[model samples]
Target: MNIDHNDEAIVIVGSGAGGGTLAYELTKRGLPVVVIEAGGYLRNEDYVNDEWEAFNQMAWLDPRTTSGSWRIARDFPNLPAWIVKAVGGTTTHWSGATPRFKAHEFAARSTYGRVDGANLLDWPLTLAELEPYYDKAEIAMGSTHTHGRKPLPANNNYKVFANGAERVGYKHYSTGPYATNAEEYDGRPASIQDGFNFQGDKNKSKWSTLVREIPRAEATGLLDLRPDSQVVQITHDPTGRADAVLYLDKDGNLQRQAAKLVAVAANSIETPRLLLMSGSPMFPNGLANSSGQVGRNYMRHTTGSVYARFDQPVRMYRGETMAGVIADESRHDPDRGFAGGYYLETISLGPAFLASFAAPGAWGREFTEIMEAYSRTAGLWIVGEDMPQESNRVTLNTSVTDKNGLPVPNVHFDDHPNDTAMRDHGYRQAEVLYEAVGSTGSHRTPPYPATHNLGTSRMSARPEDGVVDKWGRTHDVPNLFISDGSVFTTGAAANPTLTIVALAIRQAEYIADELRVGGI
Candidate 1:
């Protein structure tokens, strides 16, 4: 079980949804894996329910710079994303919504056609090709409203949201396809309905790599899950094959771990950052920058929120943070003045987050009134497909360095015309939905630091168009793979965690088979 530096082990960076799941899958198949994670391991019992305290404890607060015309730049200039630096990555902080991507979403270029200033591309694979893996991921996550799993009970927030949806003439509204448990399954207990699903599910009922995949992988005795080990660079051999990795251990010591193959799953921002940092004479642009698409075409899913206040108390923060979803608007319609679609899903923030994010810099009576009406507020988030732009990207900012003296990632974004139109349509539709439920007043919240960061290294059938191929293997480096949301060719309307899990599952199978045949 002790994999030495020279052992034939697969080194996976960033133990999030992708790396964590891939570690388990490969280890379960009798392959040795070394999972290098940047943050320390925090168990379910270690999670704090308080919002601000939990954010400090689990968030990746390392130095990052942002540049864009997007409102996030004006509001939260330093924090470009709200992902975790813990063992489970953002899965510990996710809302547990697990909606699958629509079939048309895979072919965004073909379905939506070309829009001005949008860099749209069709995915290498289709929904049909990933369906079986989706099923496997859903079952593994114990997703509600799928595979005979009972749905989570509708809370008061969902009741109001669903009622509004029905009144608005929407057809599909449900309390699930969510990943939280309705009853005990997979050895994890049923949800206690503690409403702390966002601040790390302490109950162990919600699916996260910390609760499920990492522990299972550890049990196999083939996974060397090294926490607090920050992977810095991937080294390649003379023939351009990745051979080893250099990382900073917990005590600030540099360590080298040899690898038969390397898989980077360090989220979209850090994944591209690591690849860019590994640049050498053989591959000057970056490790996988033969297409110059290593950090281009970034998509954060055009996002916003609508919070409505009612006469009676709604107590939106009673059960799950995100459970109910209305999928009627997730269809592609050119008449909507946008290329891709979006989803209106229930979202409840604690009083602190609501006050801070409902309106970032508003003051005086308006902000105070929103705080006072917290008990009677029902809110839903607008998550839709944001167009990929060639200019929006993550690049290394050598001016700002982290504690390790490594350059931090500078995320630059600009809203495409399609993104702006889609967000506006979503806000109007959300107001209509809330109005149908007799809401006294409504407030529109601008997009927060993105939780769903995707498509810096996209998948493409041709090598010149993207960083990875259909199997997630980097087109330039046969022994290097990108096992994260960065491989998404286009952002879909659905929550991205489920698709990320499915892709990791499929990637694992391919990796194991290729290894068996000595192909990489």
Candidate 2:
């Protein structure tokens, strides 16, 4: 019952939202899949309720360097991303907000017009084209407020958020469209409101790959889920098609897995790093770098945080970490002093994290005063569409070698003017919302380690424009694909999980049809 190293199987890298969902979908369709995860397999019960403890257990702690004008370089210099490395990937630690990309978001290039210092391109596919997959993804994830699924009850934080939005005359505020179940639909229980999910949801109430896709995939017996298998390179035949993957196992031994098809879903940084590392005579630069776009146009959504402290206790952390969202500003209005827009969603951080991220190296009366108002704080995250620039990218730091003696990936970024404008506008609007609710004071926190990493392997209508085609197939290497946020054309003003899952589902359907007709 073991999959041989020489099996003509579909090999997938990374087991996050995209890869895990694809594995389940393809396995159910009766195809063989080998999912190689670079971290250990931890079940729901293994999740730690404590914030710092859980962070140590799940966060991708690999050595990564950050070089950017962004505040993250000054705050979290070593940790560029706050993603999980475990079996379920970052889905085990996401906030579960499932907002769909707006129709205009797909055509950002044409809709927003040309902005200086931005490498904007319209996505090859539109919202209308992917709407059906989004529906299927929502149904599969049992997303609340969609397809008859019940919405989650508003917590104290949400009540405050909704009140503030109402006072500010803003619409489109809601408790869901979230992937977490509200009334138990897919064998997982409803959210118990324990509020430890951002740490790691131990209750199994939240939907994650550990609680859903990975298990369903295992049940089909067509899955070979290998944890602690860090891929070093992808091997290709003289014909320039991917044929094998070279990885280092947990025991520090190198192993090669033969494949008929290879899907790279190792997030944005690692996915492109692997592609760049897998250089050969056929591809002097990298496997999919013929367009010179393998590691370019890298983007992390424009982000900031605002916390308002009122006179009375709101106990924001008593429920979900992120419970509600306000979509009023998630639009493109040139008069607003920005090219694109953002969303304001309720966010709660445990005291330890707040102290660390709210102000990285601050101490004194000002810092102490902020921490003292934890019980009275109502916080919101501003996630906006950031312009993608060709210079904002991930590159191999040949100067730094990893544990396996391979050059480590260095993430380099510089915030575009559009990003700064968007963030400033979002922050100003947030202050108005809080002031509308009679808040005594508000604190604005700079960007933290990125969670919504996108691009680096984007889709394009032409081969010279990007790394992948609309179907996520590599332009230079036909049998190779990207199945994560790496394939995002432009980062829309929404959480990328739902879309990543939707695209993975769509890719699965295409791969299935192609396998049937020998197109691959």
Model 2 lDDT, residue 327, Cα: 93
Candidate 2 local lDDT, 388-438, one digit each (tens): 999999999999888888888899889998899889988888889888888
Ten contiguous residues minimizing lDDT sum, candidate 1: 1-10
Give the best candidate by lDDT. Answer: 1
TM-score of 1: 0.99
Error of 1 at 188 (Å): 0.9
Clash number for each model: 0, 0
Q: State the displacement of the C-alpha of residue 80, model 1, in Å, after optimal TM-score superposition.
A: 0.6
- After TM-score superposition, the amount by which residue 512's alpha carbon in candidate 2 deviates from its true location, in angstroms, is 0.6
Question: Candidate 2 — which pairs collide?
Answer: none
